[model samples]
Target chain A: MSFFSKIFHPSSYAPSAPSLPYSYDQQGQTYSTTSYPGNYSHQQQQQSYYGQGTSGGGGGYSYGHSGFPPGTSPDVIRSFEMVDRDRSGFIDENELQQALSSGYQRFHIKTVRLLMFLFKNPHDSRRLGPKEFAALWSCLGQWRGIYERYDRDRSGKIDLLELRDALYGIGLATPSSVLQVLISKYDDGSGRKIELNFDSFVECGVILKGLTEKFKEKDKGYTGTASFDYDEFMSMVIPFLVSYD
Target chain B: MSFFSKIFHPSSYAPSAPSLPYSYDQQGQTYSTTSYPGNYSHQQQQQSYYGQGTSGGGGGYSYGHSGFPPGTSPDVIRSFEMVDRDRSGFIDENELQQALSSGYQRFHIKTVRLLMFLFKNPHDSRRLGPKEFAALWSCLGQWRGIYERYDRDRSGKIDLLELRDALYGIGLATPSSVLQVLISKYDDGSGRKIELNFDSFVECGVILKGLTEKFKEKDKGYTGTASFDYDEFMSMVIPFLVSYD
Candidate 1:
């Protein structure tokens, strides 16, 4: 089975990684896992991460975990590396918030945390790594492009109608009820007609991606239908809902 | 409470969503939720979606869900919106795989599905909307940037040494032994040194993010340094590591 397939099959899953195997020997800064947990079957097969993100590289600097992520701009990567002043390869939620603020745009801490939560890497889910950071930048770039293109009136942000166009532009085509839900979520409670700023736009976009991605897995045959037992459903979702940062 | 915080504390969470409330009706094809689900307390304040992702405008502009994801692009959102074809304000795994592939690249179906298992939206958990899509994309973007930067040799991939550098470069400074486990998981068994392509990189990055994120929630201040009573740990992680997916 593919590594990912192994992830959802919880019967074979071991949430607790058998006590880390190795600990930092206070005397020697070195770590070792003398005995692996099922050789860390799923963890190794699917657990190691490379989160090390940059919610626009928010904080001073932090540490990094180990793992690989994929394709994005060198600048985004450079932004992450440069911020790794401690040479720790990772950026915390703050650092990530900082990174996005400096490198991309200033995103709210809530947004940044959500960003960290969604696009987190395999190894470092808490922080930002090069790979996930890069992906985030790219995704942002894509979202930005859409926003600009769809903000028909040049209002800087789009309205419910315009938002629909934008969503339709990229093919999302949400329903009016669903659209209202989206608009309300990013409404900002300003009580104005729902005009989405770039940040709001991104939040909307990633949530769509994250949730949709999760949904598709269960909707076998792409019939837009699937069923889950109670626990199964929770396992399918809890991650996005679960809070760490 | 922050929307994210509202997600994990399940008593407040209603997973089923009251049966979609409004259906296509098959007549005019218009959808309306006469009564929102608790005004979608968590869904709106927390529920509601905006998935519609790209997984790379997957499979013919499927449809769109609704919810506002933040910090991403409209395309990413559009990608998310487009993917939700169901307009249920969510995208199932099949849709997500399509979205990722359509919006980003052709992700291994398993990879996208597994990611859904790891990252979920409290609303549907089974699918995505704009809110979660942006979150996933944000993390995905970060992953991309890291992958590019860490693949220093321009070989389009990384070896154990490079992986370590990449992880360290970001902040996820994992132990060498642990890295070994990560490498072993993605190896192609070509009898050559272990190497990871972008897909493996994202997989590793996300897994790392998912596991760490989950562990962090339970571990609190320090990770790998916290102890859990068997039940608590299981309850905390069983949702993600369960066979439900």
Candidate 2:
């Protein structure tokens, strides 16, 4: 079966799909197919606002007022410039990927591409200038803050003990065995102490955060217990597996 | 077929499954069945640590040194007490659910149940004391901070415009139509201005975050595009659907 057909299979939608109340066109633009209850003045207002395009700033690229402008941290800006290897005052996909993976761990290529897509100016798709880079930098700053909070010993890197603490701090009740696997997987293999530098640390955090959210969704009863038949478990894990591959 | 059988069908494990390296017994406990490459001193250390139980904090509930104690925020503490309704100094499942669903909108029961499980002491699952409540509250605080940062008008709530920016800020390029559907779904119908209070705000954030992560996992080629067959789409959405139900 084709990918789209598999995703939009009739039976899967038959029992409970009405809850979505929206449909997608061939180009993947979503539209509301069902009439929402009530007068819904706000929705109308939004419709008109979106209709205005530039005035409403309603398109995919225009984030409207809530989108904070990028930060002005010198260290962060310097890092961005340094990564812009060509000195063209802009960082492209390759440069950004290199910055994230060099001297650390190799990031999944897709992750690098997504970051580039998100931070690149909507007007200029080829590269990221300082402002756009600053926004990306700020997001990293948030992750860095999380990393620092978990790095209790003030060490530049996170040891196995600290990693365990960091996972729990984020509210994931990760099994000891799973934690064991992660430490072994990310360790630099230097045989010093199983530790992760900032880049590796952030990657681990992202994966754990994503997986934990998915697990919570399945274990909705909050029983601290979840059972997944083999197929269900495979579905839950396929993304992680595919990414690693 | 039963859920477990569906998930664990032997055929599913025949080829690609070996890469997972972990297997579950009847109780759902995960153990590594494959020997990892290398001597893996760190894994040995962790095994010994976990083996010590009380000393190593290996049990499922122990959380070990990784579990940081709750913060001492007076305002946050007050909110927990307010939710405790019975003045018993503890929030039971019902009270906690009521608090989350009370003024703004009724959250999914499963979501509330999951929250309860995550915060409740593993040994005493019936209710949450101030410390446990505080931890949950602090996590909410992080979400609130993100909300406020995006809520430029300081209106104490998020409108459609703000919601779009918030999603983008978190790296999701949700189409405008999807944003419209979300706002309409959450608006209380009071009609002043379609907006979301703190509780509703946090709920929206959680759903968007989960979906975005899933989407990214699939769009690994970094083309900023993804296609899902019917089953794939259903898997992406089942969590949101089940929660609403």
lDDT of 1 by residue, B160-236 (tens): 88877665554444456556645554434246886776656666555444444344343333323333332233333
C-alpha TM-score for every candidate: 0.37, 0.32
Candidate 2 chain A worst ten-residue window by lDDT: A15-24
Writing each residue's lDDT as its tens digit, candidate 1 over A127-149 gives: 66665555555455446556666
Give the CAPRI class of candidate 1: incorrect
The lDDT of each candidate is 0.45, 0.45
Predicted complex 2: CAPRI docking category: incorrect
TM-score of chain A of 1: 0.62
Q: What value does the lDDT take at residue A164 in candidate 2? A: 71
Give the best candidate by TM-score: 1
